[model samples]
Target chain A: MSSFAPVLHSEWLKIRSVRSQCLALAAVLVSTTAFSVLMCATLSAEDTSEAGFDPVRASFFGLNFGQIAAICFGSLAVAGEYRNGAVLVSLTAVPRRGLFYTAKLTVVGLLALAVGLLTSATCFVLGQAALGDLGVGIGEPGALRSVVGCGVYLALITLFAAGLAAVLRSAPAVMGFLIPFLLMLSFVLGDVSEGGGWVDFLPDRAGQQILLQNPDGPLNPWTGTGVLVLWVAAALWVGGRRLMRRDA
Target chain B: MTSIDVTQLTKEYGGRRAVDGLTFTVRPGKVTGFLGPNGAGKSTTMRLVLGLDRPTSGTATIGGRPYAEIDEPLRHVGALLDAQAAVGSRTGRDHLRILAATARIPARRVDDVLEQAGIASAADRRIKTYSLGMRQRLGIAAALLGDPEVVMLDEPSNGLDPEGIIWIRRHVRQLAAEGRAVLVSSHLMSETASFADHLVVLGKGRLLADTGMREFIEEWTTPRVRLRTTDDVRLSAVLAEKGFHPVADDDGRWTVEGARVEDIGPLTAEAGIPILELAGEEPSLEHAYLALTAGEAEYTAPRPTAAVQEV
Candidate 1:
């Protein structure tokens, strides 16, 4: 166990010191946080008379980018060995495939959660402040839940993307397959799809459940989250099985 | 105790057999040069021993356990398959750190190995900025992180300069001196002559010869004696009288294969043949290897000029 700790620490160093994960996470936070502020500031004063704007949902719109970064990090973890033919070196060091896989997943998961939570909180606060007359405050009935939920949404979506990338084990293949799938769900699945009843089952739609400040969204917050978690678990199960059974 | 035991180890890629029935013990305190051509399965065999690749047929073990079964492999056996295999963006120290961490070695081991491989001063620099020799040193540092008993290096001197080549040779020799089983592979036979105590010569995916240095040298070398005498006619007559075959050259010299040096010198003097240049020629290890792997010499090192006479 202690031996594995250095491996984990090294993985952390690679993640933080390297360009990919840091840059991608930064992009996600900056884009999403900026978008939330811009959207809230543009909201007209008349909008407040009708209903409050969802500050949490507005804060998390950049999760779409954050999710991509998760996939990149995860895919690189497993597939980097293949690209360089260094898989031999890795397996030689830590022969247990399951342990190796677990360490990678743990590192990616922890980092994604930390960055997602930070980004979500920052986006929520900035967006709420910018809303002025039209914005929903944390004191509002569902505002805090929505704000926190946005963070969970970011983490879950990122993990799910990562698991998918791991299973595929090819960067181009995962990117090519997942990006369109994400785009389809966020854009195409949102329209002409029976008020997103089916779309709500996809990871992107289900993850969005936590961002509803009105507390009147189609799926209840927990159930929608469950749907997202189920998708992530299922993806991980498939990915983990593939990795376990195949030769590294 | 067996330094390394490989039993009927075999590896198949798709339909091709990479290592076919490769079974040999690598004893400690001696270098066993694994000689083979490109794509001749040297790396594949090493990979199987390290448990990086599963053998299709047999087992390869060290200390009575497969490599993958070892608790701390880097400490048990160190290998350098490729120096540049680790990511290039990380610094040299960082790359060693990750490997050292996995092996459960002390953090100081990273610096220790860096120093051992003589690259500690450049530890803080990024790997991408490293020269080829620097990367090779980093790779060796990673391998030595565990301070294992067995060290396997694949072409550690592949792209190195003459000085770097000598450096690797000295290090490898030192590793063996410490009673480690060092298996170094190369396609060149000349590299093995001095480096290997035991030689395993391979050609076109099959074992051509496996023997000790002295025995191989003796067996491969054909015996010949070169004699230069002023009285070529008298020597030829003495040779004909004794029924010995004498092949005279343009230099008024006779070359004999059966006569001993003691016999040749005295016989020439007794026969009234004043000798000028008299020397015995024996075959070298390179000659033996070329003769054994006749058609399989993929790339023989060009003979250097001012060649030493085989006397």
Candidate 2:
């Protein structure tokens, strides 16, 4: 029954102390909103084919680029400790490996959640403004859910990257695997699978289910996010186990 | 007043043993020096104590429990295992702040420790810009943040300037004087000899010697008599005639082994030699360490070639 408040405070200070990690979080909002606005402004109603049009997803289109920033933020937060053996000092300060790790994850998770919500809401309002009559309202069906789901999606993606970073113990390694898998692999899998199959259940694709104006495939919006949550849980479990069993 | 007790602690990496059956107790109110050669398990043993690494067998306890079992561990034991273990981009003050927060210490203590470590002037600067000496100071500050009863520092004086080294020696002595247990590790015999009251020497992951500093030095190092006379040649001849072997150093001093000041004074007086300097030279910690680890050293540097030796 150890209190985690102090450890959480310390982890927050670690994240806030570095300029690059803060910049990474800020990028999540800026890149996602800016790219969504750009896409929305360029989109004309005449260009909308039934297969191509999805106003709710388009409003948060910058997520394609912004999510990378979120991943960088979470991965670096944990991986930076390993950069110069700072993890040894951290472990010394908090000898209970499980407590220290849980505190770290909590701080990163909350921060990502905050940034994710802000990015999702801002992208929605601004993208809808640019879309004119083509845009969906907050009261429209699935509109609020997609906006809120975008926030949860970003938070989960960041934690997922954080988990991988903890297990791998390097920012570059996490980025190398995550960036290609998220940006390229999803599209490649979609192409290989044609339209809809198990590929839609991939963590990213499954999570993005809520962001769509029209729900499709095997999972509902909440179930798709649940799949991403499972991925996050698996990653954190392995990372925590490694931290306890392996030598610092 | 708690003590660190390690009983038959062992750690194996793959097939090689990093720490093997090491047992020692570091009591409060003294600086126990952990001396060993490279790859001799000094760092590995410290890591095991801190619970940064799990032991393969046996146990290490602070007071009466393992490190993880203790609540508020920082308040019980403070350690500086590696001076360079700091985030480069964070300010020195912020680094201390983070650790201070984790220990549930007041924020004001961060400033106090920074001032105490003599790094107050550089506290606001980024750690990346700090010199190794500054980082060492910052690490020490972090260790003191919790004001624990036990302190462990590994190679604390390694990159320090003369003043910094003196500061550390005095600081460690003060910590011990305050009834805190201190365990400091170093490979340099001369450095540990300056301040450590007790010694724990290791070789190849095994304890080679564990005893008081003075006793270990006295038992292992030979006490010799050094004689500097007006007529060194005459002194050597007279000493040889008396069946005494005197080795002449480059400074024109004769080192007579297995003899005390009393033994050399009369011999020089009988030989009509004017003694300019007559002192008993106690063998240094370096000599005792060399003798203790003579056969157990992991790697030995090759002796100089004949040509270089002649020069």
| Strongest candidate by TM-score | 2
| Angstrom error at residue B294, model 1 | 2.9
lDDT scores of the candidates, listed in order: 0.74, 0.90
Cα-based lDDT at residue B22, candidate 1: 79
For candidate 1, the lDDT comes to 0.74
Q: What would the per-residue lDDT of candidate 2 be over residues B1-311, giving only the tens digit for each residue?
A: 79999999999999899899999999999999999988899999999998889999989999979988887788879898888899999999999999888878998998999999999999999999999899899999988999999999989988899999999999999999999999999998888999999999988899999999999988888889988888978998998888879999998888998778988899889879999999998789999888777755435445568559888
Q: Give me the candidate number with maximum lDDT.
A: 2
Poorest 10 consecutive residues by lDDT, candidate 1 chain A: A47-56
Which 10-residue window in model 2 chain A sums to the lowest lDDT?
A43-52
Give the distance in Å from residue B219's predicted Cα in candidate 1 to where it truly belongs: 3.1
lDDT of 2 by residue, A111-185 (tens): 999989989999999999998888788998889999899999999999999999989999999999999988888
Best by DockQ: 2
Q: How accurate locally is residue B275 in candidate 2, as Cα lDDT from 0 to 100?
A: 95
Per-residue lDDT for B1-311 in model 1, tens only? Answer: 33878888788889788888877878898888888768878888888888777889989999888887778677888899987786666678877777777766788888888888888899988788988888888887887788888988888887777787788888888888999998898876676665888877665455666788778877776667788877778888887787667898787778887665776777777867788888887666788776666644534434445255532
Q: For each candidate, what's the DockQ? A: 0.53, 0.81
